[model samples]
Target: MQTDKVLLEILNNRFSAIVNEMGYIVYRTGFTVFVKETQDYGVGLVAPTGELFAYPQEVGVANMLGMPMEDAIATIPEYRPGDVIITNDPYTTGGMCTHLPDIHLYKPFFYKGELICFLWDFIHSSDVGGLVPGSIAPSAYDIYQEGLIIPPRKLYREGKLDQELLDMILANCRIPEQNWGDLKALLAALNTGERRLTEVIERYGVETVKQGITDLLAYGEQSARAIIADIPDGTYTFSDYVEGDVTTQIPLRIKLALTVQGSDMYLDFTGTDPQIRAAFNVPTFGKTHHWLTVGLVTFLRTKNPSIPLNKGILRPVHTTVPSGTLLNPVPPASCGIRYATAIRVIDVTFGALSQAIDDVVPAAGAGQVAIVLISMPDYQSGGYKVSVLQPMQGGSGGRPVKDGIDGGDFSAGFLRNIPTEMLEADIPILVHKYMFPDDTLPAGQFRGGLGVDFRFQVFTPHCIVTARGMERHRFRPWGRKGGSAGTRALTKVNPGTEQEQNIGIIDILKLEPYDLVQIMTPCGGGYGDPLDRDPDKVLKDVEDEFITREAAESEYGVVIRNGRVDQAQTEALRHRLQTSRILKPFDYGSEREEYEWLWPPEVQD
Candidate 1:
């Protein structure tokens, strides 16, 4: 064992740098805008045991830190120096690749006939053949409708590309040329990893490099356990719900009972609702999946960001997602939009942890990643021109110390929005308006973040629009302490015109030329009492147009007059509001309260 801490640290940094460099290579060389612009990809260095030993933190997908590759690797018969395995089937890959659109590739690195490590990378391809143009639809009832499911198989053999396999895979996709280019980019990244790992092995002996990997994992485990030990030992239970499944109007509940004891913790999702017929199922494979425990990893990162992000962080925590539930669904259940339910898992985790340590966790966030895709006839080209207009998301929750980030959702922080110029240039669309709405945020001592209001017009005729992962339209994001719940989402068509129409929670919409589409995202929940907010902060918010004068006075209990704070009136109003307020652990807004009244938690379970 390598007991030298300095040597291990040096090896760790070197290995991390290799993967980080590989990620940048993919980003720069990728052909599609999805990879180059949004960066919906991940790169990591995996051990022979299939656990991630070193992962890139600066680039690539942030939530794929603890993804295990054992199940996918074991399916292969043998491994050679230049052989690679490719898969995107969630069940066959053991949840390593959650959806089919994300193409995962793995290549083994050999050091003098001995296996050193495996290079792993995945990119969200722009289009895979399916019912919808984007290969994802909220109404999809089975996996077949999502896209093509590729099982673990050899994509390359003995440094040679499998032409037959490559051709077949590309033929099934809608955009064959683009998919082939992105696959090559992934191969380039894997090649970079191989060269870098070989150089490291040459400098330090293979044995020393292997020992350093073990030591780094141990260090991460130790750090994670130490942080977990700080929380008081207890079991905390919390429950939250998705507004509705795709096929049904009834809300689906996700329940969690988090048990923390000493340096170990266990999360049980036994009481969760059954899997829906829609595409909201999460394929966890009944293990400690990354999506089930990402909140803990995020919490640890917030406490000590210096810790290397790898699978070791998951050692101290365990998860139990019951079969037939939304988190762990059986085969044939569609998981096209699993990210929507994954965000709720994060919220429920935060809700449970807050009961154990109130000050550490934040309130509920706008828990959805609304993806808007537009497909129109391409007159220049023979086929249709399909492109993603925007992957719109809401804001983060308010913290005890500071206000939540405005117009920034934590769920898809890594996926950036396409630039306006690029969208207009590539597609027949015009961005009429894109800005935060005034007074839409929930009020508190540290108010919730503001949400976005986006309006655009289609310049092309016979355009079809599809929006997936829409939430917070009915039940709002709940607040904590005396803070208020955030606003809900809304969608409209041709607003301010005589032909204006309201489309509430739509799966797809057909449009003609000059048809306007407006999408309003939800905000995060606030933390602490609204009356405790500073008057100056309220005045500044009013001036910035994030909040109106009426909301500053009514919701926050802060009085503003002549563009300034009325200190005496504010103090009196705050005192009165504080006296009348009834504090609750959670404030789920009136909409949820009304729904819960009819269908209580106990009855649902």
Candidate 2:
């Protein structure tokens, strides 16, 4: 506590409030539902050195806390009051704009003729004009097909909107008006940040405000270091694979060797598969980017729930994502589906860390977040309407002491599912079912959370459906310490109909009138052995229809008869099953077990 602890706490709260209010303004004023409801946006204040110094804890995208601004800011010739720079080029921005669909805006905050800080924010535009309607397709071969790539440019000059530039950008997009409104909303948020920062300066004076920013960052760094020092120092290695690339059925491997020494951690992704032709590459620019370090960030947060959300937390994290690898791909490699690779990165990081501190980490979660988009012709307007059906996700992994959360993943836990009413009102679709399925969770002492089954029918003819980030079809979420693996994902078209089709995993699909689409995401991996589970819990699960009597008996060795647990029979069954069961440290599903047997880790290394 180099700075006054009381003052640092006060300043931290005030700065966080400023960014949260900025996010609120954008959420209320933005045009698209993605921004207004789903909140696919972020707002923060950056230091002159480019790292975020202040960020909202409870607003916008939760994982975008460490986006760098120095490279993008350097591209600007000079900054004046009210000048805003905009860019969506991932390569040019040094990974600040991760994907083209994410349009980033930065405004320099000036006070007393000096640049004190910067307001940085961005929103995921609904449509940015590309090969697909939503500007993102898992099959995109390169960056050219993803969407518009805007290099760092002066979007606003000298407190005035660059109308020509803005109009040019809008004209190239499918939803011109919506994009324009979202951009305006971003500007409003930046203005809010500017005003609030100015007020803080006026009240506390510029020197104190600057000192406060420095002190807060230092505090965050100290807190992160303390947490990291607690972990046992050692090198741990782990590897995971993407089921397949969009262009080919060959699985892509992601490898990591994490070394922890004192309070410093180094992540090496040397043996990972090279960048594929599809849009799954992550452009990290070989820096310690957010995607490469989010797992460590999550770990720090879990260790210290009161840790500040800033770039200081990443101070001790060092990374080596070799160029041409999936984690650090070269230019021309499509990055529209980078999140697909990022999810695996999170899982692999967890896998490596779990070896060091097994009890602190949970088993593998349902490691995918899919956004279903529907586009069809609007007869009244004679134009197409694009709307997000839902940002669907699966369940988190079972923890050491408790069950996983149902229908939610820990990686993007902040994102909210679209309500059925909202979907029906905006899109021409009928929601028939949206609920958790029974018998899908992995059986364990602390059972995994249940996955979701969403069934809907499209009323509009010739509607196009695209689901991005669909994963875990072949490989199930792995369980640890004798727990069972979770279920696999599935997709169906016209299920239970005469013309039924099994669309196992898809990037884009076409639908006719009355066509039903059902998406069933995977459940999370369980923790501990099923036989170790309490008989009472198994009885409750059966009564609630979460598990069938057969599942309760077979999976957990619990004997249930006529809705009541037979205690003596349950004890006998548990004893018999435990004697026959063979436990393993990691329970990867059969698919992975067979795949690994063919392509062993030693061979890959």
lDDT of each: 0.85, 0.87
TM-score of every prediction relative to native? 0.98, 0.98
lDDT tens readout by residue for model 1, 134-253: 788878899999888899889999899899999889888777888888888999999988999889988988899988888788888888998889988999999888763657877788
Model 1 clashing-pair count: 0
Q: Give me candidate 1's TM-score against the actual structure.
A: 0.98
lDDT of predicted model 1: 0.85
Clashes of each: 0, 0
lDDT of 2 by residue, 1-605 (tens): 45578877888888999999999999899998878888889999999889898888887988876676778888887899879998999988888988898999999999978999899999998888889889888889999998888999989898888989988898878788889999999999999889989988888788888888888887888898898798899999998888637679777899999999998889999999999889889998878888888777888888888999999888888889889889888999998878878888998998899999887788888888887888999899887799888777888888888888999988777777888998798887999999998767688888887789999999888899987788898899988888889888999999998989989777789999999999999898998898989899989988888888999989999998887889999999999998997987789989999998998889977
Kindly report which residue stretches of model 1 are placed more than 4 angstroms away from their true locations once superposed: none
Model 2 lDDT-worst window of ten: 242-251
Where model 2 places Cα greater than 4 Å from the true spot, the runs are none
Looking at model 2, residue 3 earns an lDDT score of 57
- How far does residue 599 in candidate 2 sit from its true spot (Å)? 1.3
